[model samples]
Target chain A: MDWRWDFTFDVVLPKMWEAAGVTVWATVASFVLALIGGLILMLLKTHRSPWISRPATEFIEFIRATPLLVQIFFLFFLLPDFGITLPPLTTGILAIGIYNSALCAEVYRAGFQAVPKGQWEACIALNLSTYRTFRDVIIPQSLPPIVPALGNYLVAIFKETPLLSFVAVAEIMQISKLIGAEYYRFTEAVTIAGIFFLVMSLIAAFLIRLVENYVKRSILH
Target chain B: MVPRIAIVIGLAAFLAGLSVATFAELKMFLPAILRGAVVTVQISVLSWLVFMAMSLIAGVARAKASGAVLWLAVGYIEVFRGTSLLVILFWLFFVMPEFGLTMSPVLAGVLGIGLNFGAYGAEIARGAIGAVPRGQTEATIALNISPWNRMTRIILPQAIAIMIPGMVNLTIELIKATALVSAVTLVDITYASVQQNQLHFRTVEIFAITLMLYYCFAQFVRFGGDALEERFSRHLSKRV
Candidate 1:
């Protein structure tokens, strides 16, 4: 029941901020993987051929239906059975990437659907190649609408980085727990960690809203 | 028929092979993990109930209110929606204890997930409520139905049907959020897996089993949600 202001000020503040850097890095790396991975999955599922698309749909559904933490645990622990051992950070990043990819795939699909069929026909009428049509016309039109949704998911992933602590990737939560264990002032340690997450998420949300506003204005214009 | 029988026999053989390979390991860990699974289900169900109740309130407030109440509801939705369940879990576990209010780790976890997802559910509920035609409310009033009855019988049931998809997504999210409870030192499936991995150094096997367990649990829930959705839609169509 006793709160320790000094410990919050002296111990947790400094330590958590330092660990926050790792959390941010993990978020960035995982988000990059998620973006690329999601784009690929989205493209695969939406491809012209049923042969390629059907399997991708099923795979995405499987991934979407499962929990990410379980997938992270599986990757961290199970990859070794196939003789693939990764560092904790790598494992954490891969897990976030794969899990977020499934959600992002849906986002991208929705974005793709939002593109009018007329645009595709217009591109084809102009004799643009499929690659050029997708790159120059379809994707540019489709992607902006999806930015806000993608941004929301990115922030969600940033918050989820704490789960990486379970695999011994010493992100913010793990660091806080260590600090708490060392000082026995879990109040200060965990509170500081929570504050760090809250602030980062707020900033992420603000930035995402800004992007959403920008997208809306551009679309309107 | 031969190919069908062959496929069944193949699957049986594969299952037997996996069992032989894993029985010793599973024998050690399955009982512990299954016990943990009970806690997992309890936390999941309790949080789902809490979120649904609180979300309905928040959603209705957002839908009906005009000024500061609306803003407060919006703020609640944004803060909880933006933040991770893990941070909420940590706050409830560590910060709440310092505030002279300590709960069992399980309670803390359930409340955190409930409140967090409740915010999301509120948004879905609000959207579904808004999607209900404005004419429906006018018609209910014209018919002299009590406001409470109008909402309970006419508006809410339809809104729930519409909200099912979003609610299903939130439910899956709640299931995942239960993993964070391990941080509070509760012996969840993840915790048991970690304990076994540490003890036997069979890290991959233990974690793999836990992953499969989660997939199985999640698939079951998703199936149930789908069935509920079908039932609701059928009932709605019959009414129409």
Candidate 2:
């Protein structure tokens, strides 16, 4: 195996670092959408009315049942057919956001359900509105604990950013692919991209654990 | 209960509308797509086999073994789990050739998905095995049960029940990742659907069927997992 350290450091690492910004940007942007979008979906699914609840449940199921790659394609390729032409990067972010939103909804549902039936009963006993109850009680209890899971999704969104390269977003994976094609050397660029993902996600996971501990401490005191 | 009936009726009406609207196009493409589904299932099943093997060995090693074996297993799980599956796919397919190792696209795709999901599966395995109570181990020791019998009869059943749902989730994810094989030009269902879209330029009809097909595959996997879990957890009683 022909490996070149000097060539990799001098030539490819800079390009990869620039592209890493785009990857991280897409992860954070899509993750914001996922957090909000997931809560909305979860609220709808848990609504008292069967009409809203059933449809939300079905929509979440449909999204979860299908693959994200096709969803990305469905957005990037199919939307233009209906005259909604988004930029490639926007398309990628929207697709990832929408796809992971369903996942995040499941996470929220698990956390919300784990809050114990007594809490919900007490809220009902006190005649609290659903919004007030969730905002004041249920979500506060649930969201903090689920931070680590959500953070895992953050890393997940980071991993999914590579799929965005398919639609020509010029993210890290795309840039690495182009570099490999141009330089006839796939090893350095691809391996470096892998390392970028590994290091950033490990850091994210570590930070998430610290946040979880701090949240726990503050809750206790 | 009312919602369940409504959902059934709603789904029927939706399918009726879809058939009325896109019957001709769907008829033309579905057989081709189903054939591609065979390819997808082939890749999924093969990769699942490899995933199971890797998960079992590495997961057991991580949970129970010590020293180099444990570290090696830990390294396997983290390195593969840490990065994107597509990177692994591309590495195996594109970069491995540079390192004097060559493989077919199908082999690379299978190995990529297998190795990636195997790492995730190993995590589930380790967690499940670890979830087996220490009391159970003490009980086995007190009863003087053989090691193999203790694991097979007492611990593994509970652990399997604990981990089945997670394994099923990973299997569904594996099936979804099979769609990535299309990027590597494997002519799986995703590729076939894209091919149909390329030919007819009918986006809505093709994507609906494509998505539905994948959804069915996931439901199928979930069905199997549910049955397995039922068998394993029969003694646990109905827990909410």
Candidate 3:
């Protein structure tokens, strides 16, 4: 295989960098939605009794099992048939948020599980209400440890932003495809896009690792 | 928070519109869409079976391999896991032919799904194998069973039991990845949705239906996996 190093520099790098901004925004916006949706779902699952609990649990399970792409398509493509016309970017962000929320819910559940039973008893003995217990006692304690998992999913959702191209969102992958078609250099275009993802993920991971270490140190003291 | 609230309200309104548009599509294309759903199910189930077999093989290789074999297995897993399945499908379908390895669209899609899932599965398999009690392998060795027999009769069944939860999660992932086969032009649910959307310009209706179809199918898989896990663990627990 002939490797054209200069082609990537001249043709692919600048185009992909421009596209990377759009992708990063989509990921961040979607991640915010995910965090909120996931928090709500986790609270629902925990606070509700059997009737509501079962449905919430099942919904989370369903979202967890299905692919994010199908969910995105369903929201973006199918909703308009019934009379909803959203911008492609909005739809892409919504879909990512909903799908990632399901994942975050699972992560929250695991984090909650990791909380020692004594902590719960301590909250109860202090006469804290359930809401206060969760907000003040549980979440603050559980949230820090799950930062790594949350960070991992953030990276995952960023990688998956490429799927948004199917809906014609002009994210990084869409940009790559555009440049590749124009230049007839799929290798350069795709490789540069891949590097963008790799670099971004590495930076995000390092930041998360730093946060995790800081949290650990503070908790120890 | 305000933007997020607006988004939620917007989504609710969108879903309301979807119901109206959905009825419109249903009047003209329900039969065809329902038929396409059947194809979607067929692809999901068949591909899942293949994924399970390949994942098991890949996982076993990952867990048991040493020296160069181990690195090769690790590299295989990393590449497949790292790249988007869409990129891989494009290469498999569009580019492989340039190298004289053309595949039928269905086979190519299945291979893409199988290989992608296999890579993820390998890691899960390694985790499951590591979780198995250490003495189990030693006990088999002491009994003088052939290594293959020992694996088939001893470690695998137990590992399968332990790995059920993870496998169930991966199965759902496979279901989602199948949508990418549309890139190679498989007329699965996503393709069907796109077609209906183009016909009616009611993009939301077709996509909502597609989402529900996948959600229901995924729920069924999760339930079945959990049930099977319960059954397997019961027998193991009883023996202990």
Candidate 4:
């Protein structure tokens, strides 16, 4: 109950807020990468030839089965030995992006599968190019149902951004740790960071639910 | 099937070639890394038990309880689900000591991971419970079964069948999450890999082995879950 208002406001709060912005940026950047990478993975996985799809499947499985922390560490520490050094932020984004692309690939695959076969048949009958069929027909129908699932990953990726701090990315959790180390008062700073995460994630969840409802209603109509 | 086997052999050979290049270094690090893997398994299994207990309580409260109890369950689920596990682990490890509350590294890791994953498991439990047909509950009530009997006998069996697959997925996730315990200084697999890499700078070989070890653990959990699901759902075919 012994809360220091001045320290909370003057020191921890501002630093945490600034770091929160970095957290959001990392999440957004990585999420975008995951989306694009996931789409490619899904397409590659669904390819007719096992030669291509099999490797893609294994790659997805490999990423999914491993921890993001190890992958981040691998990128941060190991890559430099190969003469491919990246900044911590870039490393964070790549690690999270690659890890999440697997999950997102599964979501996208499920979404694509849920699209009715008749739609594809009709496109084929009309002699629509495969590219056109996917771009115009398949993606539109499949994307809506998967919005809620994808939105869940948005929150998931947001929650995971703190892992970037281990690589010295200076996200909110890292800032809290720095403050705690400096002042030897981890309670307030860490609690504040946790509160920020709780609030942001709740807001993100609410927004995702709203989007889910909107997509459902529109599709139904 | 032919192509699948070929691909597997190809991947194995590729990994073997990479390891062979650094065979001596890998041999040096293997024992320490295996020790860390043991710790990873310990944390994962203990935390999974805690997760299941917390989830069951919160999930049942969210489903059947009312008023303050229900709100408390909801609040617990939301807060835990929202926050990062790493932050929670740090808070438990660092902050609690200031309040005259201290825990060992393993204890802090288990509590942090358990509480965080418990929230996700609660949602799965609540959903599975909801998915149980209303007719079964109605039939139990009509039979004048006690409330506890109704839940234990009729409702939970079906709900459990629905819960198994999701729980399996979550278990795999939990295993992967155990890697983060290294952050709190638990000397788990990731920590061991980092240390080995620092010592010899054979990052690729060390981490590749670490990654494979994690994959093996995940596959083990997945197979266990599948077996449990089969056992749980066995009665469905018998009834039919």
Indicate the residue-level lDDT of A143 in model 2: 67
Please write out the lDDT profile of model 4 over residues A1-221, one tens digit for every residue: 36799999999988987887899899999999999999999999999999999899988988998899999998898778778878899989999998999999999999989999999999999999999998888887887868999999999999899998888889898898889889988889988888888889889989999999898787655
Candidate lDDT scores, in order, read 0.81, 0.86, 0.77, 0.88
The residue ranges of model 1 lying beyond 4 angstroms of the native Cα positions read: A1-4, A47-51, A80-85, B1-25, B66-72, B203-205, B235-240
For every model in order, what is the iRMS?
Answer: 2.4, 0.9, 3.1, 1.3
Local accuracy of candidate 2 as per-residue lDDT tens digits, A26-70: 999999999999999999999999999989998998899889999
Question: What interface RMSD does candidate 2 have?
Answer: 0.9
Q: What docking tier does model 2 reach?
A: medium
> Of the true interface contacts, what fraction does each candidate have?
0.67, 0.81, 0.36, 0.83
Pick the winner on TM-score between candidates 1 and 2: 2
Q: Write the per-residue lDDT of candidate 2 for residues B1-240, one digit (tens) a residue.
A: 234345445654886687778788578877787888899999999999999889978888888889999999989998998889888888888888888899898899999999999999999999999988899999999999998898778887778888999999999999999999975768988888888888878778778778877877777677778888888889864645
Model 4 stretches astray by more than 4 angstroms: A126-132, B1-24, B237-240
Q: What tens-digit string does per-residue lDDT give for candidate 3 at A87-123?
A: 9999999999998998898899899998999999998
Question: What's the TM-score of chain B for every model shown?
Answer: 0.87, 0.86, 0.85, 0.89
| Residue-by-residue lDDT tens digits, candidate 1, A1-221 | 77768877787788877888899999999999999999999999999999999889867866775667778877876778788888989998999999899889999999999999999999989999999998888877886878999998888889889888877788888898788778777776776676677777789888999988897787645
lDDT of 1 at A148: 90
* Candidate 3, superposed: residue stretches over 4 Å from native: A1-3, A48-62, A77-86, A126-137, A195-217, B1-27, B98-100, B202-205, B238-240
Give residue A107's lDDT in candidate 3 (0 to 100): 92
Better of 1 and 4 by lDDT: 4
Candidate 4 to truth, TM: 0.93
Global local distance difference test of model 3: 0.77
Q: List the residue pairs that clash in candidate 4.
A: none
Q: Return the TM-score for candidate 2, rounded to 2 decimals.
A: 0.91
Best-performing candidate as measured by DockQ: 2
Residue B126, candidate 3: Cα error in Å is: 0.7
